[model samples]
Target: MPSREVHTATITSDGTGFYITEPVFYAEPNYEKVNYNNYGMAFRIQAPPGAYSVYVKTTSDAADTIVSVSGMETSRLLRGGSWDAAKLVPKKYIATARGKEWTYTYVNGRDYLDIEIEPNKINTPVGVEEIVLQPIPPQQREDGSLPTIFILGDSTVKSYTFDETPMSGWGQVIDAMFNPDKVNVINYSMGGRSFKNAYTEGRFNDILMSGSIGDYVFIQFGHNDESTDEFRRFGRGSTESMYETYIKEIYLPAIRERGMIPVLITPMSRVRGNAAPGYVYTNSFINRKFPDIMKRSAEESGVTLIDLNSESVKFYNEIGVEATTAVVMSIEAGETPGKTNSGSYANGHPSKKIDGTHYKEALAKQFARIIVTELVKKVKAGDSTAAAIASYLKADVRVAALSGDWSKIFPEMAGDTTTGEGAYYRNQIEKLIQLGVMSKDPLGNFNPDEEMTVGEFIRCISKLMNLEKSTFADYPNGELSREIMGAILVDAYHAKFTSKPKYMTDYNGTAVVPGDPDYDPYMDPGSRGAMYYPLVSWQQLMDTAQIAPHLASKVKEAYELGLIRSEKGIARGQMVNGTELEPKVAVTREKAAKALYFMWVLQQAVKAENDVSSLK
Candidate 1:
């Protein structure tokens, strides 16, 4: 294979070779200084098929430094001293400049060479001053001894780039589960590629041409295959029958032709509402039978099968919609950087809108753990193919210790066994606590009968939906009024999903304030204003100015999303011209839970609807 000259390289930000952090906040020139306490820096090195000696010069206030290339186990740790002593003893934290060298044979592709300074493992920062590369001799390179595991699937399994930081696929993180010295993982999965397009686009060919004889190929698809829409792959995606045929006939046979082992994995599930029952949430979606079809195909072909769909569903459902957002790419407004369908935030932080389809690094690692754990089980049951892969798994992954259920994973979410509540909204309150939205005081009392303050409600709702944490920093004291609560709920929903509510302004452009004709606060004739904005849209309540200016938009959105219903406590201020949103009436904790329940239900409904529409 051809090799490029090894030299002291300048780290570029945007090209084929560069250095970047995991969350990708910024890339420093030459990668000399790093501010984050993380194992996130990945530097790309261009190399050919040969063994090489890599020399890295670095100093740190941190206690240790670990460096490893792709397909290699990281075992060496360069020990240092604490930076804290520098305050009293000057130069105590100064970097001990030394060149540490690691020798490894070059792997295929320009993969990232990761330098991990164990995150939170050290309290101080680390700096890498230089990296020098030198090729040893052709004789030193390992000659196709280690078997490679090539991953093929959609966005859920593909490895992401620096720009796409924080978003990782299971294919990318699965490497961590394996003993790198035993196996090499090369992810060929691409975003939006179904069974048909993956073959058509020569992704499969890339694997066949590049991989050795005994390599393993993991095949997973179906997220985009069932689509009838022309937007994805210009309608080249498969139908149900087509998907089945491609898997059993074309995909399996082709892998066998290349003397490769084929492992089939069903597609994972999407995020749904807490209101959805386990059965309904797990099984309901466009082409929901895809998993079943995959199971049947695997049996007929006598291929090793991993049922990730069922496992992932159980995981998402147990966690609930609110908890699931952490793993998926559901970006809240101002969380990182604002992202809407139209454009990005001006400040330019990394953020995305409410994305249910893709997995963040957290979820990707979880799913990866689940997949490997299943393989470990198969090995124990005496499956030859699974044994081949499971043999290479890290010691911890060799055991089936990872649980798909959230409550088992997080004990606090299960709630205190000794305490209980007897309120009418007891179930709702319990669910909220389980979801980490609400908690008990020192006395173990939820105090559900008492009125919920505006500040309290804001914090609970924000935590429940994983909205921008600082969105409502102005959490005012005092009981949240019924109308204000409605506004807050709708506002949070919009901030999360980015769905704008419909509205219109009068042609006369009148600045309407509170206490007008229909909004007359004290029921006095003089309190009634001269002009009134007509309730043009039922989606838009007539007199929004009647509420506080800060809460006016949310109240309008509440009407638009149908979150606010006109009932006894929730009143229409006017008897004739328009509905009056009762702004002064306080909402108790139980009533707040009811409103929150409606909002949660709406979240799942919208997701399900979107899932169905995507199929068309």
Candidate 2:
């Protein structure tokens, strides 16, 4: 299908990609006009009437940057959806926050797809490169056969792009929990708004009219609700108190009268304590008021209640604070990576200061899981209030997996590979998806079996190395020999470390193969197969001809990596089992993705460790 974009500094965003400022300002730029603020750059697109996968390419990179897009809603603090769906992981890791990562998220709404990039902290710039909005004709559903789950909340429940890491909200991943064929989750939250902001603005009344009987509205607040600050406070009357005011007076009544369901979720906890074993709770005021009011309101208002406030605290305290920083915003001066191509990040945006309250995809997914579990519980108990939306939860492997263990980052497989068959790399596949390396294809499918060409592998590795440019895409596309893959990989790694990695034929090899479940070292005794080939070939009554000694090391390394079984059988996505691998065979996309993502993560972790060590 055809696609278009609207660049900043241009009129009618006739679909341009990037500009120095937000769409409302200086219709053009000469580099001197840009400011270093979070909302300085924005993308405005008129997405065609169909389902589409939206991607935002930014010039700036924050570890936990937030990619938010919507229509008909001003920016509130509440976020939506699951962490898995938060497309905020980096295409490459930089020692600094100026690293640019692309965000790929689902697009289904009115014609306008208003996408904005916000740094983890305010006043930080979200540099722009280009915005690609392509409409996928295959997934369009005009018949309204799919139910829509509308989320209304603060920054904690907002839809954040996972490309930025921990900035994602629970509402963002809700859509992934349910089958899209049955429902569409639309997050209409701004990161900072509270009930007072939402209620006073008539947001509930607005939703009441457009929503029908089958639709469900999830309302969560309190993180920003208890603010004594005048600009951020809301819903403060007696009968019109924080949690009670809106749901009792407006939401519950209207939604029920309109034949719909209104589910009330308490706010998730803030990582308000030090990363110690027994940290103090500085956010006690909110913990006390918001949840109490929410529960009371749910009881009095007769709405279904999902107590996330209590659950979040329990989970938070259990994991402790030090680890919480990875989920929230807590990068120290020397701990953060890179100092190049970044200015504002150097000055302290996303510093150890502001990330205390805002959380990311991992936290968001947990919160969503809690909410789904609570909803399912009530629905199963036959709560009249929740009966309307009970069908929204699934009873299949997806739900079972999520409910059974919240630690599993990726949801159950959606399309294929549901059965526990030859999917040894299943865990790796999910990790790749969670890391934003395995996004849905342009046609909106994650076809794991698609053939991965040599060019594609190089491009994938290039992006992982943050060396992606027009050059990598220019590589030849075809099945690659084992030696060729290793040679290309070693070259890239060699350039980064300035240490010439011995060629595949030079060093023993890297990955684990069949005979060597423990990566038993292989030595070239003058010639690789001059001895073994004769014995094996004579025993099997086959030709004594073996893999060329020069190329055989490639086979050996491939074997150790579980890439090949024989001298020519090229295996793709096998685990480190003592099994034979195929050689010189084409690799599948899943296999290629697993390999590149695993290596990238491994290398990045090592780099971060080294960076930390240098500071000490």
Candidate 3:
């Protein structure tokens, strides 16, 4: 039979894949881009050559939405359908969030699935939320029952939506790396899930219920387990404690009893946090104690272990720090040129902020290859367990090298420092550029004297500290104010230090200010009846009405910490008893560089102190 040529139709996308948007011949002739109710969307499923059933789930805003297979004479009602005819199977329906499931059988391993939306009289916009492609196994096993590989991990291993494009998981593409005709791959991983939460949420139970004997279950976690706060499943104890309580005591035994092979994989390292200057790895989450705990758990449980942490660290280091941004979900405003489903993310949405933890499609595919390649290596090393799963890999599959000119990742800094050899900030600026803490403009000029904005300053600090999930994208690119910069410096300080900074603790001063709640004009003769009130603490001094209430205390802390330099030759409104903050004044690039240097120096002092404590 000849295939249908639907090239003239516009393509509409679901979460992970797209479908053709053909005109709804039965409904209005016009294809409404704003309201999809007047159009039909379809996608052809291409799977391995075999007799199987395709299960689809869809949701729409309109009640009269129809789902039917090709070659059908009339559209079936959403309520009921014949099993033999392959029509709509109503799972459940709600007025606000209506959903339905449909099943279609194919003997030729392919079929055209179409979703038809009709224009509703109520004028409510209609759309399809999700389309899940579930390929049902054949009734009879021809090749001795092919085993399934189950993946259990965090966001780095879960499938992402089309809107979340460029943010893919290794598991999403791992199946393609293997010979699909030989085995099946199912990913049970979810974002923001720790091992404790996953097990508690019955995710493991779902896998055990569906898995059979001789199947492989690959487990990886530990992106969220490091949280110290009570929320997000915190206080679940340390990494070692969680490993012992879950893997050694429970999960491994359960899998072994079920006769399924369990393979433990260490979570991959983050690009920013793990990349150290002149080193393969830094002392971040992966390098600290988590990977060691994973290794110990695998060793004691006698499970096949894959050290993804070490391998990924090596990969990031080889690619260099600046190039790491290419693989991860790090994009500056308007950096990527594709239109998202919402159309808002194109011109620099907040979601486009720097993400060091997640991987883009290219790196995700590479990581999948690395996982399979490691299994192949294990098989070559004569590991019987790895040998069992090595047959599923495609012929001669190898890890691909991350290509691109590394030198071009960050253009050379074009600045003249020869005339200012004695200038203090020149060396500091050079160090910042070399460390990848700062980059030159697209025109290749460092522009050291250019006034830094709040966004630029936050980014520089974030890079220096390797802060994950920095949420300063909304900060405007206008010249940064001293007061706002003070608040941000305190944030950076708290990221590393637990106690109050030495400067804040050492300060002892009081000030007289007006408009205080405790102000009594006639109470003190020293006030001169000007409604003056004594500011007893440094916090009170910085908690002026001009600053936002939430940031006022932080600004005060930053000022006392000596991170904020008092302005010289200040105006009348800026000076308070010869202590001029000039809080509203724009910070120059030179001053910003000096402030960052002070913060870095303080961080080093804390690090040195901690190192000495460790020695003791």
Candidate 3: misplaced stretches above 4 Å?
1-144, 229-239, 273-280, 286-288, 335-344, 347-353, 398-616
lDDT of 2 at 424: 29
How should the candidates be ordered by lDDT, best one leading? Answer: 1, 3, 2
Candidate No. with top lDDT: 1
Q: Residue 343 error for model 3, in Å? A: 11
What lDDT score belongs to each candidate, Candidate 1 first? Answer: 0.53, 0.47, 0.52
RMSD of each: 18.3, 19.9, 21.1
Report the candidate with higher lDDT, 2 versus 3.
3
Best by TM-score: 2
- What are the models' TM-scores? 0.43, 0.45, 0.42
Candidate 1, residues 1-616, lDDT tens digits: the string is 0111212232223432333223222223443232122443445665543334465554432234445444122321122231111121111111221343333322222223333332123333334545666754322224857888988898888766422433468887788778988998877776787776665444564565456667899988978876664223223456677778778656676566556789999989766422322333455445547888999989988999999989998876665544565445643211111122222211111222345677555577678878987897887788899989888887656644444343333222223221222333443454466466666776656666678898888888877667775776655667898777887776777676654212111111233323235443334322222212222233334445567887766776565444564433221112122345566678877567656644443343211211110101
Query: How would you encode candidate 3's per-residue C-alpha lDDT over 258-343 as one tens digit per residue?
Result: 55789988888875623334544443574237777888888876789888887787776665554455456653211222222323
1 or 2: which has the higher TM-score?
Answer: 2
lDDT of 2 at 51: 36
Candidate 3, residue 266: lDDT: 85
